[model samples]
Target chain A: MDPTEREVACFEAGIKFGTLYHQFAGTPVSPESAASLERAMEAAVENQPHCTAVDVAILVDELDTTHDYTELTGRYMEVHMRIDYGETVVRTEMRMEDGYPMMRVVDVHEE
Target chain B: MDPTEREVACFEAGIKFGTLYHQFAGTPVSPESAASLERAMEAAVENQPHCTAVDVAILVDELDTTHDYTELTGRYMEVHMRIDYGETVVRTEMRMEDGYPMMRVVDVHEE
Candidate 1:
């Protein structure tokens, strides 16, 4: 069976989450570069269809600065995304949970 | 409402695809770096839950070759991913479609 609009809305949110995480995960970062990278990541995913907004916060203090820069990963960031698919809307976010980076849906609705 | 197992499986597959595409999209690549990037990308996504395998092919011939490197993007690569979620398995691939790098599911089935 084809997916319902709600399912698709969930799928779209998932895609944004995946895209946001994967695309920026390995970028080099330091306290100096974190802000720009966050803005760039937000702008990148917002370019996708159905995405209304993307918020990224890179934890510079937690970043490993041994080499003056480190690879970005879930541990160093958190994200929020809002996606609207037709009348169905989804809000999702990713943050550290139980020592793991977890992406979870906050709400799903139709308007 | 809750997403079904199948829906969750589909969502997982989407995450892997997103991770694969985004995490490596902006990487600096040349023929010399393509092979190593491919291997590293595969290993990275495979660390995610439910992801079984990842295959990445950086189109060395298609690379810009200017400055001996270029930022990676969907146009410069092709990818295939397999994910297993309990009894549900999903197969997907990404390629250039109609001038856009499109990621699509090839099959979703239950065992």
Candidate 2:
């Protein structure tokens, strides 16, 4: 079955964020693109009106690989991403090196 | 005093990582840019010969703001980044919405 509208909206928001983030990393973008990005972001927030209540985090290791490039050699980060959720917060981290994603419940009192 | 070469290297690596990360995030780049990014990655690894020994994680909430763009409105994530360290792992999370970054030692003994 297809994803629900809200689910699709959330996924789109993530993609839009990722797109704009990279697009504007060290350069300027056209005002038109910026506007589109802004609209997407707003839609995302609206889709997750209660995102403030979820909290999450993820960690991973031994997930990157080092390859030798004939002209240029280096390691590519293949980290993992994690998420933590709770009564009033939502946290998400992606560890690209590892292939799996994790979700957890947070304990705020200990800290 | 100015940052040491090694420290500078670390900072540069972070920057380069961010740069390449955003640059090649969704779109492909020229072979030249790709090669340069690869070289920088290798240099970063050489600089962090012992990153495998550190562990860290960061969590934050109450970040992001919505602004009116006239033409389009959306929220921007101004999160904080937290780092967790340990004997064999290093975990870092950027909470863009929050203003502060955090660091902690992992308690792997728990599930």
Top candidate by lDDT: 1
Cα lDDT tens digits, model 1, A7-99, are: 567667877889887666778999998999999999999999899989999988999989999999899998989889899877888999888
Docking class of 2: incorrect
Which stretches in model 2 have alpha-carbon errors above 4 Å?
Answer: A1-20, A26-34, A41-84, A88-111, B1-20, B26-36, B41-89, B92-111
Interface RMSD per candidate (angstroms) = 2.6, 15.4
Per-residue lDDT over B1-111 for candidate 2, one digit per residue giving the tens place of the 0 to 100 score: 232222222222232223223444332223224444344434443343233221111111221113211110011111111111222122222222343321111121111
Best by DockQ: 1
Model 1 per-residue lDDT tens digits across residues B1-111: 455566567677878888777767788899998999999999999999999999999999999987999999999999999879889877778899888997766777788
DockQ of each: 0.37, 0.04
Off by over 4 Å in 1: A1-8, A25-41, A56-77, A107-111, B66-68
Lowest summed lDDT across 10 adjacent residues in model 1 chain A is found at A1-10
